[model samples]
Target: MIEFSNISKSYGSVQAVEHINLKVEKGELFGLIGPDGAGKTTLIRMLTTLLLADEGNVLFSGKDVVKDYLYVRNNVGYMPGTFSLYQDLSVEENLNFFATAFGTTVKANYHLIEPIYVQLEPFKKRRAGALSGGMKQKLALCCALIHKPEILVLDEPTTGVDAVSRKEFWEMLQGLKAEGLTIFVSTPYMDEATMCDRIALIQDGHILDTDTPTGIVAKFNYTLLALTGKYKQETIELLRSMEQVKNAFPFGDSIHITLRNGYSVKEIEGLLQKNSVAYEKLEPAKPVIEDCFMDLMTSH
Candidate 1:
């Protein structure tokens, strides 16, 4: 439903996005996974017709986003990365305002947002600014869905939401997908990448890889040795110094090490024992999205 053909964007001397080319199929939940300043919002703005690309084309349903901006704008529901609603307006008023702006009434699309709106109904009288983060999140989502656009573009929607709210938000997205809404969501959270149908791992304004979560993990060609110990940093430095270790980085409470020479597991354990690094655990593990992401970033 969306396509970017060699798209690039820049701000003065710095490039925000670089030659991005990707497609989003109908009813597909696609993720733009990256950290802050990774150019996700820049790309989203082009897709939403809010910003023009420095080069190339952004097409939505075969319509050029620049020359045919009205169609793109009218067909998309965009929730930006930041909270931008009127702080003084009550939740219900904010929803009504957006719905009216789209030439529709909230009542007309009540079925579309009922699941999410029901949660915000209790806080209907509360001013948007006075609502908690999670409540504000729900309210924003309701307003976005009030018009029932063909595509939904969420830019880091769960950035500051609590764990429970984050989980709720993803659940709502899944429900929306089942209703046949094409969603283009971005997030800096690595764990959320697995929740989407497919994801593009972006960094430094470059797309490292785009694939299903499992496919990305399968692309990891090295053996991952997850090591946890009291001396975590020391173990990582030692592993990095070893000629056999190609990449060594800390992940969570464990240090993930990749081997260059395909040495035996016994050999690794022997080396650690000889060095007396005092590790609590060292073992091979299946590759995850974060591991694949780090591997891609480091290699790039």
Candidate 2:
């Protein structure tokens, strides 16, 4: 239920976001996947009416974000990357405060946040500053949902949390989606991109591609090879120097290599063997979203 049409934002001589356009359907869980300094937060701010775009318009539920800022603010709930809750305020107090600000009470919308709030109930008396990363996240989410807004906009909600907490948060998001709340989440994690209904991979203030995770992977035209051996760094360097190589990137314990035009997998293996690389494990792999993302970034 959100639309950004050719939106552009700038500060001084640098442009944070440029000519951006996107649409989030009602009840859809949309994701913006990008690394740091990729204009994700800048875009979110513009969409939430916290920051104005220099060009184009942001509309929420058919209302102009700039002209109906108050209406948008009342309809959308935003959770910033960092915890913005009052450090001294207890979890429950913070929740109550936000509920009151939105002309409601925590109890009034308790059912909406029950799934997330039950996890934070034990820490209700603890100061927000004293809560763990995951607890703080749940508390912030509770506050965001306290008003039962139609749309939820979260920016890097799992950045610093542990893996378990991150998984739990995603599960909670899935639960919220089942309730028909439109969610727009931004994350640096490529794996999380698969969790969304559709994602836009962004870099350098530009959108590289926007599609379903499986669709993006399927669009990778090049054959991929995963190579691992005794010498990892040397293998990477050798692959980069090879004329047959189109792209080579280290992914975890293996190096992923793509062949150039007119090159074949057998030729690549022959070349590696001729160089005495002592490679053991070598196999073709289906392209993943991260691989697509890396290729897109390298090509650009």
Candidate 3:
């Protein structure tokens, strides 16, 4: 278990994170979802004892992170956002180095990494720098798990990887969670938020909201509709001009309109037709995590 109380961090007068308080249950997959400058990395560093929080306390399994930094470090595996592995070493050699540092060997904890290592064994002789993005990711994850730590802290592990590799990485994490490992990960992709048991949306050093995917979507207090057709931007501009439209923005190839009170499907459709907008389709659309996050960021 990991717990933090009123934890905050800053660089000079700039606040990186502020008053963050949360707990991660054993064997649960938790996520921190946000964009690049949302302070996810700062909070992760503090939790792993790499960066000290100027206020509050962080505890892991009843052990304070500051007071028991070394002991806590031994019980956790941390993978920063940047690729920090030995570039000159072979995939096999890199694993050996980390295992030795933890006073263990790959053979000792081979079972923990069997599923991931199976794919990497073919590239065992390849230098860390020679591996592809997906291969590098797998190698990094394998090295982090070499010690069989109780919890894994990964920061943006799939940032530059291909779509297929990103999907595979999340699948591997699900396997780890089933083996009773607490997984705490951060990602900028809002679509990935639904994969976790619970998620906290952060922006500008503050947590906007924390809840399950469905719970977050339930908080969106508006009737959402997807509009896709010719003159998409014009349709958005038209919707934006109406006082009844609560929100209007482009979502992929479609425009998402949030209708206000008294503006139902009929009124919106009539207005669009009056403006000579050729909409191929317009229908009620359910809100997702992205929609909820945007609302929180704007209203709060």
Candidate 4:
């Protein structure tokens, strides 16, 4: 339902996004996965008609976004990365305001937001700023859906929310997707990439890879190993120093390492023992999205 063709944007000398060619099919939940400052917001703004690109074109349902911005705005529901609702207004008032601005009423499209608004009904009279992070997210989403747009575009909707709230938000999105709404969401969380039907890993204003989560992980060409040791920093440094190790980086409480050709886990174990590295575990590990992303980032 959305397409970006050779899209490029910049702010002064720093490029926000460059030559980005992407497509989001109708009714598909597509994710743009990357870290902060990876240009996800810039691309979303251009797609939502809030910002213009420096070069190339964006199309919504085959209509040029630049030439038919009004249609794009009317059909696309956008929830910005930051909470952009009025802090002083009551939840009901805020929802009504956005609904009226879109030439609609809350009553007219209550069905579209009922599932989410039901959770916010008790606090409908409260000021928006007083709501918890999760509640504020629900309110913003309600406003975004108040107009009953065809496509929902969320920019880092779970950035600062708690883990449970984040999980709830994704569940709500799944419910929305089941309603056949085309969802294009961006997130910095690597684990969230697995929740999407497909994802594009982006960095440094470029797309590293675009595929299903499994497909992306399958692209990892090296044998990976995970080890937990008392000397976490020393273990990582030691692995990086070895010729048989391609790369080593700390992941959570363990260090994830990729081995070079002909290098075996036994060899690594022998080295750790030889160096008197007090490691409790050393075993082959499955490659994850982050690993694939890191590999792609390094290779690119």
| Model 4 per-residue lDDT tens digits across residues 100-148 | 9999999999999999999999999999999999999999999999998
Q: Choose 3 or 4, whichever is better by TM-score.
A: 4
Please provide TM-scores, in order, for all candidate models, with all chains considered together: 0.96, 0.96, 0.94, 0.96
lDDT of each: 0.90, 0.90, 0.89, 0.92
lDDT of 3 by residue, 1-300 (tens): 988789889999999989998888898899999998889998899889898999999888778989999987898888889998999999999999999999999999999999999999998998999999999999999999999998899999999999899999999999999999999999998888988988999999899998888889988878898888765566777788998887877777888878886668888889877877887999999998887887778778
lDDT of 1 by residue, 1-300 (tens): 989889989999999989898988999999999999999999999999999999999989889999989998788889999997889999999999999999999989999999998888888988999999988888888888888899999999999999999999999999999999999999999999988999999998889998988889888888888887766567788888887787888788888888765585677788888998798888898888888888889889
**In terms of TM-score, which candidate is stronger, 1 or 4?**
4
- Candidates in descending lDDT order: 4, 2, 1, 3
Cα lDDT tens digits, model 2, 181-216, are: 999999999989888998999998888998888899
Error of 2 at 177 (Å): 0.7
Task: Tell me how far the alpha carbon of residue 113 in candidate 3 is from the true structure, in angstroms, after superposition.
Answer: 0.5
lDDT score of residue 274 within candidate 1: 91
RMSD of each: 1.4, 1.4, 1.7, 1.3
The lDDT of model 4 is 0.92
Q: Which residue window of length 10 is worst by lDDT in model 3?
A: 229-238
- Between prediction 2 and prediction 3, which has the larger lDDT? 2
The residue pairs in collision within model 3 are none
Error of 4 at 48 (Å): 0.9
